[model samples]
Target: MTDVLARRVQASPDATALVGVGGAEWTYRELDEHVERVAGRLAALGIAGEHLGCLLETRPATAVLVHAAARLGCVLVPLNTRLTPTELDSHVERAELAALVCGADTADTAVELSVDVPTASVDDTEHTEITVLDSVSPAEFAPASRDADDPAVMLATSGTTGEPKLVVLTTENLRSSAVASAFRLGITPDDRWLDPLAVYHMGGLAPIVRSALYGTTVVIPGEFDARATLNALERFDCTGISLVPTMLRRLLAAGSLADSLRFVLLGGAPASEELIERCEKRGVPVHPTYGMTETASQVATARPGEAFAHTGTVGRPLLDTDLSVLGGDGKSVDIGETGELVVSGPTVFAGYYGDPDATARAFSERGFHTGDVGHRDAGGRLWVTGRRDEMISTGGELVAPGEIARVLRSHPAIDDAGVVGLPDPDWGERVGALVVGDVTDAETVRNYCRERLAGFKLPRTIAFADELPRTASGTVARRVVRERLLDNGD
Candidate 1:
């Protein structure tokens, strides 16, 4: 199709396009000019049609670069700002980037990187070639005409279990995803979506794309602050917002949410039933979603009013998307049978960047084989059990960590819970749990789980933590939990 932002500006030039947390606002026309100016600067640096790495925080500058990349026909590689220098280096090398862009917050990490590429800083005070939106004297420019299959952006998967892979999303993939999301969650011309997720994650990046396609507004807080987000909802008259369960929990605890909010899209990880119940009780309109990096942002989302009824279910697939639960023989399993989940549709990513073997293994004749295990009920609702790789096999019995974690969260004393397989000489691998709550006595929590879960599914070992480690997307970091258990000599 055509340039998303260019088309939006044509439709409604005076509509508010973006609002920063610090009271900075830009209309559609102004934002288009900013993107064009930034694209001109990149053109001067010979960055056209090349892979560019961006290590920036959530701000207006980051959104400008995202649109500018599309205009220049360059592949934008959104780097995670939370990654360490070593981790950043690995991604830079993997992408074979030609140039790098950094915001003021990540300038030090950009300098420390070993890659020998031209670097530009997006800070206004910094006297660099990339001085924030440096004027290039208004001139005639047009977005490069691109094929539908051309790669638009490359985002890294959350490497909770292993090394993250760079997913290559095509122009069509993004367009389809935005269109499908709008169809599922009706879009209004006056809709303003509040975004609090990091730009590196798909959850954050998709809103910018969707807003452009729908010609609407996106209000972004500088970062995720419970109080600030609550204020933003009322201040901006936000009709919709996206958040992880952790952020939602904090916001609910802060106080009553704004009545102006129409919908709260919750995902990034499996949401606990207790959390969903709390939202329902508070009159919060939450739509529990299930998606991954491979499927753009959301493949399936529960409807607004139906969320409380289906509690833990992620609802059905979005428009034009198909999902199936397959057995070991690669055939569709019966309803309510837990197996691997596979997705197929225009919204699916083209492939993993520069990894043919992985690209081949990830997809089959059926579709993209998501390594997640879940089932679909007769009513066609999907329920995610856990990751196939994360399953705990103890005493020759398989146990899903999500099943145990859900039960632990039901206890009034437990605020959050994460389960992992711990080494045990007797059982091969014993069920271990890390919990955050008021209760310090392990026996009391274990007894609580004993009533809800089966004997084999019960956690044999329990430890208390002030808070669990989380990735940038706010999902509990299982890998970190396993490492900490080893370090603690448990």
Candidate 2:
């Protein structure tokens, strides 16, 4: 369990471990061999207990390095490839990375970092000065044995608000997440998960670890084109896939689902009821999940049956996990009460990386304060409303953006919606909305909402956009939406 690849190879030596669409394929044994080589390369760079930063995308190489870092006993910091050097400077310094690894595409960005950490490259096709410059034989290196509580990866939170925190994920967190997800989703030896997500995020990285633990296959696509992803699903005989709401919507528009597909794990953001209904109509097994980087991946997920039954719920908490909705008084609220969501479990991360104060503020007596506002139903299904900080105080009445966005999405003409609070002179804040669809105008959309919403809940101002800004995980970037609204003078 310490060296997951080594153990996986021991258990299932010939099982398919990784499938690079139109590229290379590796069995568990081969993958383990490659991982050991990569770990040897890192060891040659003098990367010992120091944290290692990986500025790479979702590719076969990145997947190998993930296990390589674990094998070397170096805590991994999966740097976001989308971030600029300036945006990444703080994270690089905060993590105090000892050595940085880059792929062919991101090698230049790694050079741009202000920090003076040793850098290496892993471009298999080219032989540059930094490209796999050193190597050690498998007999020369020994994989470090890691405990369950050992920090595995220091992953950054999806910065929806233009601010991100570094969360420390342990082996136990990843193990618990994989086990619970497998129990809920059902896994088989032939299961192949088609992954199109960025490896820097938990959604993408989890599958790399989970597939090894399950002794299954991970199909890595070159890039996320709707047609390409759809083709890969069929070509690789993939049974499962992970996607955000936006990706799901686009994939549904692309083509029919592969008959070999078993489940579509839809998470990273809240999916509208319309989207879920569409999945149901298409006979797609969409399992809407609720999770964050702090929990490794999924805290709760609604299996297809439960998802269809409870359209908006994220389903029950996973095995060994506990969820509670606490009010302003910092006490657990009654069932069906809207309050701040609190999560405490083995799957939950220990704390943020290098931010003790922030970590202290994030947890309460119960558990990690998720800062997400939601409630549990009588059936114990979790319904996440919105962020506790995102609540719009329109004339002192708190309005959850999700509630209004749900109503707006219900409109037949409206394709999607994003709601936020705008500063107002009269009221402390006014409810504002940005919508996408073929609606006639903002007023028509407002009229549609007027029937369903109360006066304060109705949007004070509305704007139209072809698309709203979204984070990588597909969550609506409300901070960006708010800035856009302000710029538009809405």
Clash count, one per candidate: 0, 0
TM-score of each: 0.96, 0.96
Residue 91 lDDT in candidate 1: 93
CA lDDT, every model vs. true structure: 0.86, 0.86
lDDT of 2 by residue, 248-287 (tens): 9999999997989899998888899999999889999999
Clashing pairs in 1: none
How many Å off is the CA of 54 in candidate 1? 1.7
Candidate 1 local lDDT, 62-119, one digit each (tens): 8898898888888989999988877788899999898888877887777778766678
